[model samples]
Target: MSHATTSIAAEQDGPADIALSEFFDGHPVATFAIDTAHVVTHWNRACEQLLGWTKADMVGTANHWQAFYPRPRPLLADVIIAGAAGLESELERLYPGKHRRSALIPDAYEVEEFFPNIGASGHWLHFTAAPLRDGNGRVVGAIETLRDVTERRVAENALRRAHDNLEHVVDKRTGQLADINAKLQEDIAQRLLAEAELRRSNLELTELNQQLSRAQQQLLQADKLASIGQLAAGVAHEINNPIGYIFSNFRTLQNYLDQLFGMLDAYQRAEPSLAAPDAATLRALRERIDLDFLRQDIPTLMAESGEGIVRVRHIVQDLKDFSRVDANQEWVWADLHRGIDSTLNIVSNEVKYKADVVKEYGAIPDIQCLPLQINQVVMNLIVNAAHAIGDERGRITVRTGRDGDDHVWLEIGDNGSGIAPETVSRIFDPFFTTKAIGKGTGLGLSLAYGIVQKHSGRIDVDTALGQGTRFRVRLPIRHGAATEDPTA
Candidate 1:
């Protein structure tokens, strides 16, 4: 025992070695020592905090294994004092591959393991143990230090799972993309025959559109209505032939698709009787393309496309109807509601972002006046209402009602910045405008005023600053001689 004096055994002596005991107890790392007999000699303050076992209970007992394991077993420090012959055998039975020789300490061993009995929830511990030698270099005891590495272990496991999941997703997507690329190559080869014809058609259409644009620019110098009329008429005449063939081709495509789907159905029914390799190949292709979903979605897509083409046709027709004021100025019986709707459709781009439009129409008879001129009047009023709106979103309301039996009235109003009294008096004067430069020509209200007068009608305005403005046009049921300008 005299050889144990210079080792950790010095701390086990009575009051004479109190300073040595205090020094070992003051260490920050969880540490404990065991003699050659496997008896606990020291347990530090950090070890007490780590396992909730006081130094008094642990310092003189061999029950240290109780803090880490359910049943008593030799801990790393106990194994370290067993001499080299028994040390390797004991570690192989307990720690196995988790033990490794410490890189920084000669003949010291380090191990990491999950100790289920360490706390309420288990903890992962990394501990190192080394033999304590006397002056003659004979092993008399062993000292072990411990660290809790539970958090690091948890993070490592999570990162491993995430990496594995990402690799699986990448492999699945790669297989799917390879299959689709093969199918796409086959489709592209078959469609190459039609690509040349489609390109030729596109080139012809582009040249025709350029010619029409030049014609439209020349006509714009004549007047607004004339330019619109020329463009609409030219587009309708030139584009309708192409649209007609396109619509017809869609029908032809539908028929071809029906025949192809019929052939595919027949092939599917005969698949079970085919050779094993052929059946497997067919099944793989169908899985790659998700053929069942495409079978359900293709008809829906075709129907939507057909509806879009029909809507385009109606839009072109509306354009022609809207621009007929200068093309045909004849007075004709027409539905005022229809005219208003067409006018709104033409100017929708101006008002959609600025304000929401609400229409309240009353049942009224057809008016015998120029349809295009009335549409023009409605467009001008609606455009003015939209321009009066400030930065915030606003509302524009259009109302129509029969004004007795011989006349009908149309009112367009907005929740916007109202016209000033001074400016209101001159709003209908040609070239008179309070608008910013390039935003207005100021002829819109003037043209509307003259058109109303031509139909022997009257235009009235009601407005207030910061509230809103309303313009009402009252027109005769039938066209008549020119009337005196009462509001002039």
Candidate 2:
């Protein structure tokens, strides 16, 4: 009914503008709004519940920052207002990092900042704000929504510190090994001590490496689950579109059936008439109910309902195939194109908003590998490609084909902001990212690297600042067939 009634109402009586524009309470996210004067005008229940400040205390005041700041610093909404009013330099002076325009929301800005007074130590708040416009299209105020991502931030920091420790070990052990070699050639007495130290270092390195691997894999799994949770909303919306129309169609069909049954009862009652039911009576009944229109529209409604069902089914299957819900990550000969297509479908929401995806697929044979793991790699590449493109209209080209007789290659290329030359080397390094806090875990490409390595393959990047970046993932036609290729 929502689908049908909305369209019908739209066609009959176009939408009306309302003056009471602020709807903070209706928003699912914790939200608050302020007027052009920077006075809080709308403070929602969620906001009050999250921030321990009620609407009565907030609404009509400019003391919003005191809730989350030590000395009333400008919040994300204030930064957006400053930027809108051409005070962008003030934004730079205030928030040097951790704040920027959100790629997901137009004309809105997002910031991830920690406020120590919010929780035990601090809570990382990810918030987005956009200028609110009145019915006359006048800039009235700005509204912001907030969410706490404290656990993820804590885990990320721990992982970063762990990575630093691992790096320190590498540096220390390299120097120790070089010294041990020099000393073993010169001094025989300390050889035992040096060998024992080397053994201890090796054991420590192994342990630290194991810890790093586990942290990275856990991060990858967490990221994957987060992706799925995000995808669930998009999938539900996609399914709802068809279901809504199908329901409307069914209602119309039910009405048609009622009218048809009424006409049949009329004919039966009039059967006992003098001339076996006068044609005029039945014709009048048909005309009253617009029987001719029903005859023309009923078949269309049924056909359209069938199409809607098929669409819903296809979306469901795509979700299942992308997740590999019942399938294990086992090696099998699979069509790489199929996996790419399914992964693309699953992440369509992420890309459709940022860039237009272009597939330049070539003839490729079935490759023997873990399909689900490869799909995960493809998903990460495509999502990263979309994010790289940012909010502007851009293109993401995915190309695939044989890389020689021994390897099959897949490349995801984006015509967006390219990576810096210096940053390219660390793009695949664990815990290294250019994304803002709460936006990435920095383990996506590293996980992809590990997956490729496990398949006896390699992932290489070609990037130039301002010219775009292309990630090429090449896998052996048969797993372990590439001689001397390292595995993770």
Candidate 3:
């Protein structure tokens, strides 16, 4: 051949030799090259080792379809044709027949079959294919490769299943936790509401207790006033008896004096000449009339009238001391005995009918208190004791003493039908009375409690049904002094 023809032929031959040499390298993948006529142009050392074939057996082979795959790979043929006609294509493929003559594959290959190829010595093969193109971007042939990827595929499928199961378990646990949290929040809300209700109930009870205390004070005051009114009526009757006699004697004396004046006037008119009587004659007439007796008797009468007026003044003073309308006034040192005596006098009428008072006075110090209010309290307690006895005569005991520390105590007890357990608790409330409607206003004990509280004192009672009742009042010895009364 000429030199130019020799160079051109050498270049063509060089590339084919290089391509074949590169395919013969001991790579793991089975590689092959095919021509546009679908004939095998080259086969690698890997293909020969995996498929039990050599380059001598597969090269220049027109059966490229049956040689590269254990079965004819139909999808590979389609992809090659389309790409040769200028289209893009991609696909995945599984290996054909099973190794060791397993029943998974047939001897003759088919397009749809995935079978492993087993050589005589029991080697397994896996296959995949792709189309090849020339520099002009036109598909000219195809290249196929194969591998042993059985272990890898199995492991990947197991891993995917495990991940899906784990996800499902996590979702279920999250749903359960959300339910538990919602229930816990609802329980907490219910407990809070219950606690709030309990607090409100306690507040209501406290308010009711305060109201009861106030009502008791009002009842005590009313009882006291009723007793005082009854006493005043008795005292009025007592004083009226003595006053009636004194007035009758004065009227009789005035009549006698009027008669004597008439006689003297008649004498003066009858004897005009003797109208201006001599001093000696006038003196003799005065002597006969007993001027010294008239003077002595008139002075005695004036003195008796003054004594009656003093008695009335004493009664008035006692009444004023017993009634205490100014209970809010400040405290002062007060004689406990004097207060008890005044209260007893005020309620004497009530007790006289059904009870007798027994005094047991002690040498107690003056108690700091509102005197009039304290007296009113005593009056209420004493009178209530008498009323409790009804028609039966009972003994009412009034006692005074000093307690430990700076306090004075007065106790009034009666031998009468006592209070019931249920009734005793509410005995001091306003308008709480066992007496008939017209006879009691029920403010006595209630007012007494209020007065004691104002003085920072306390009043307590002990009683049993059918065993009589005892009321005890404890007052401070010294307290804030009372201010001067503006009305005084």
Candidate 4:
């Protein structure tokens, strides 16, 4: 070989060896070489930085198994020995002391049980060892590389824990929400049922109210008929008294006329001359039978008959007034006092035994109303007040006055045994009364209530069991005016 050829070969050899050493030293992982005696031979800068050891301190001096893995050092022995026999194995080893060191190393080393020595605060390392072969393919030593995987493993564990916790929380919250939704559904169902029941109850109540109204109307009609019957009986009794005497007077007159006719027939049967003489006898007979008394008694009988006719006419008029058949005939401004007086006259029979009436009439405006209907209402109330006294000779005070704007007020008060608290609430209800069955019809107050309401008015009662009762009725001054009266 020439000098130039030798120089060229020498230059190529020098750079190639330097390049190999530089590549090994500058690697990002810890690099080391183990000898056949299972001892560390070479250590790179990455190894020094990772393990806190210098190459001169650990190389050729100690085995990695004795220094790093104190307990169970054979755990790495099997892995490395197996790799030397062309088998693959991986070993994990944990170091004692603070910042426990953990490592994973794959083995295919020339010597058995050979690993790198690491230090405290060292990152977790994953290492792979490959058996170094000579040109003849004979095992010589091993080169191992280690990488830091501590941060990745720690982050993966943290992420896994967080994921697990989130799943657990989601499952718990989902169960709670389902329970709440079920409760809400139950509450909604109960509310719907309650509303349906309320609607049903209201419908039933409306039907009951309609039935009660119809019953009330029937009761009122029955009561009016009863009153009419009583009045008819009274009128019949009154008429019979006068009629009996008038009929007796007519029979007496007929007997007197029969005696006179018999005397006249006797005169006709006598002889004509003797008849002239019998005239004196006839005059004596007439005088003795009292013809003048008969003539005077006949006029008295006619007068008695005329008086009976007048009484009947008056009774018929009272009946017409009580019935109010002509109530809607016309509207007229009427004196309320006069109507009240008339009502007092009609019910005088009711109160005569139990109560006395006193009137306190104030200057009031003439109210436009149906006089007959108002009279009926007043009479009913007066009679009720009398009956309430119950033979106590109580006093009833009837008063009239102008109330507030556009209203007229009438007050009828009784100094009688008043209403009981329990009965007061139902006093105006139809068929409710404190009196005995034959003495009272129970429709008096109810009819009065209806009549007052028809006139756009209200009736209020103030009573206490020993404190007497006062009933105040408020009516509009004008026919169609609104009423401002509080009754409850």
Candidate 5:
């Protein structure tokens, strides 16, 4: 369909085709219509806009297959036209079960399939095709409409990955959970037996209320444990990737060591032998073994392996510091910058792939606080920033500075999608998440809020939709409560 030919056809088309063309041109979705002979009668403006084929190139032609496929195969629209004429048996062989009859429409079919030749690469389309009939109720042709559903497909895949990760962690912890359950049952049995003691009757009422309180605490702790279980898997993976290569390098070094040792043994034996091998034989051995390459590479390989071990150890230490594994949970004078650094290291795996982290540090005084708990708050903020950025390359800027003489402040900002104004207030509310299921526990900000509050600090949010978000945490330079309550 050349441009000049389409212009002539538009001028000669019947009133009915003109009216249909008018309707399809302004339609909201990508649409096209063809006549009984499979010749394209109308290619809408939206069709041209979406499929990159101008009306001049598509109208008055039956080459619709070129827009979607490499060869002339019957499209879903063709299937609809054929099926409407009772050619169901052949369509079965043509398309198999790749498409389905539209449950909501009569004599229509819908399909969600990948169009490999569309756009820059492949694109997923959600489209439906229906027979276009005339006043006498005969099939005149077929009209097809479609839209790109690639973003929805991406979200579905992320949800699936999240679900799989959660399931994997649950399966790995099944044994630990079973052991805990067995021990819990034994504890209950022993306590019940102890309740039968003659002196226990006096405190039974108090014990019941206490047990109820403990049950609530246990539930709270269970959530914490679940969070920990999830973190453990990610941390394990972060450690494992480097360790895997490190161990592999070391194994290769071991083989190299054996080879070198064998060469050394040969040299030692030759030195004591009355009839040592001639120079050519030794030269051949060295060349066959590639001694020159080994001399240069062995140290380099060992050095790289050593660096890998250092990396693994540093990550392990950061995890320990972030989790307060071996440190007291008491409030103390702590370096805020160091705390932030450790927290960033702890969640490095989470952020590294999502965005580039930029640290903007300034001079600030150490504050009296629960350092590890503060690190937890920092981790939550950093992770939230990472997740808020959609699946595109983004940047997160972390800044630390002084706020007057009494307070110090830190900011975590992202140049990704920001929060909506209406939902900003409710963001701190527990269990309110914008993320899809299985990706968040929704306790991140809530926990961060509580932790900051305990430190007598406040979290202020600055955000604009589609621009970005920055969360600022301001704490007093020092607190007087350090001596009053050690745990605080």
Candidate 6:
């Protein structure tokens, strides 16, 4: 009803009704009331503000549904007036899942729904309606309250969408991580296989290297024996010449001694028999014995014998130096020239027959090396030089010098037929030779090359046809020293 009609009804009901009307108008909630006939009885100030229809226009009219819906329909208050018999079914029909019984008020129902005509866009509102009954418990009218919940509903929907998007992102990332883990596992497996294969190859290579080392040592021993045999034969021949002459001298000396003793015995017998010592007999004996000649020749024989002994001693000393028989293959500082000289002595028999040795020694420092091995290098080069000479007598030049400050070098050159171009390349290869079988084992140059390499040195050959060949060996002054082109 309008305010004037409400005032008129209040006047009829007395002061208590007036207080009730004032209370309804002053309430904060947007509320409206309906009569038993479904006519609008009261529209509070809050309801007028919410629906944009003043109490002056809505009170006493049955058009309250116009505020929330597009056409005339029962409001929540009308639904309550339909009575409790089919109340739940009626609420289910109107609001579906949005309606429920009020938790705080008996015989009251609540619903939250969107009303398109309630605002500029729309509004979500939660509204509750309860019955107003008479003293006899008969339904007389109903009161409805509304609350705007648009902002809360919008925020809840945004949060739900965010939660769904987060779930999708987490699932996608988990799948990607699984794929990466599989790839990494496969890579590890492949790497393990590769490592195992590499280890097997290394073990095989180590065994092969050990076998090759044994073979190389055997070859070296064989070469040394061959060279020794050749040296022994030559040394015997050289020593025999001196020994034969010395033996002949000893026989002659014995004869001279016997004749002298016979003459002395006769003199002694005559001295005892004759007063004048028989001078003529003595003279005859002296003339027969050739005393003056014996005197001169005996001293000469002794000198020659001593010289032969000295030669023998020197040969033995040279052999000792060349072989280093007492040495334990240790690195030591030694005179390269001294080693070269001893090597020359040992191999002299090989070279002397075919070549005249010319020594060109230079002032050089001692070097650190395995002395016996160095001697082997010199021996090999000299032997090779001797072999290079042809039928005609040749000159073998042995040269030694310092190369800069860090290295020393020795060159053995022969004035024989030079090495062939094809033969030069394989000269240092084991068992490769130009000599006839039984003459050369061909390990001389190869062993020499290996020794020089072990000393961190180098060997180079220079040759021209008929002009002869020169083999130069350069060695570091200090054992294990870094190597460079010393000639450069």
RMSD of each: 30.0, 24.8, 37.4, 38.3, 22.9, 37.7
Please identify model 6 stretches exceeding 4 Å from their true place: 1-211, 222-277, 483-488
Error of 1 at 341 (Å): 1.1
- Cα lDDT of model 5 by residue, 1-488, tens digit: 33354456567876865786788888989998776667777788888877889999987778988999889988877776664455576566766776777898888877788887888878889989898775788776788899989889889989999999999999889978999888888799776777687457757868987667545544564456346645754676678777778778787877888798688767846754534466567767878988768767977877787787778867766665566533345678888888788788878889999999999999998898877668877888999999888889899999999988888889999988999889888887768898889988777887777667667788888999998999998888777532221113
Tell me how many clashing residue pairs each candidate has.
Answer: 0, 0, 22, 0, 0, 2
| Residue 34 miss distance in model 1 (angstroms) | 99
Q: Residue-wise lDDT of candidate 6 within 424-459, one digit each (tens)?
A: 788887789989989998878877777787788999
Model 2 lDDT tens row, 59-175:
768899878987977787876665456545665676667668778878887778788988567788898889877579766668889997888999999999999999999999999
Clashing pairs in 5: none
Per-model TM values vs. the true structure: 0.52, 0.51, 0.42, 0.43, 0.47, 0.48
In model 2, how large is the Cα lDDT of residue 474? 84
| TM-score-better candidate, 3 vs 4 | 4
Task: In model 2, state the lDDT of residue 440.
Answer: 97
By TM-score, the best candidate is 1
lDDT of 4 by residue, 1-488 (tens): 22344345447787874575577778877787654445565678897786667777766643554434555353232344335343332333321221111244333422222233445443456555666555796555567766677778679779999999999999999999999988888799788999999999999999999678856774664466456646655665676677667667766876786687677667656635565557677677769978668657866776686677666655554554554444443456777887786567667787877777889998898898866667777887787788778555789999998887788899999987899999988988877988876877777888777778667788999998876899999888889876544353
Residue 263 in model 2: lDDT: 83
**Residue-level lDDT for 417 in candidate 4:** 87
Q: Candidates 3 and 6: which is better by lDDT?
A: 6
Q: Candidate 1's residue-wise lDDT over 1-488, tens digit each?
A: 32344344465655655765687789899999887777777888999998888889887678888888888988998888887897787898999888999999998999999988888888999999999887899887899999999999999999999999999999999999999999988899667868888899999999999667545533342366666667877887677778889899999999998898899899999999999999999999999999889888999999999998898777767777777644476778888988888788889999999999999999899999877778888999999999999999999999999988788889999999999999989987767887899999987887787778767898999999899999999888877745646254
Off by over 4 Å in 2: 1-278, 483-488
Residue-level error in angstroms, candidate 2, position 41: 50
Clashes of 3: 22
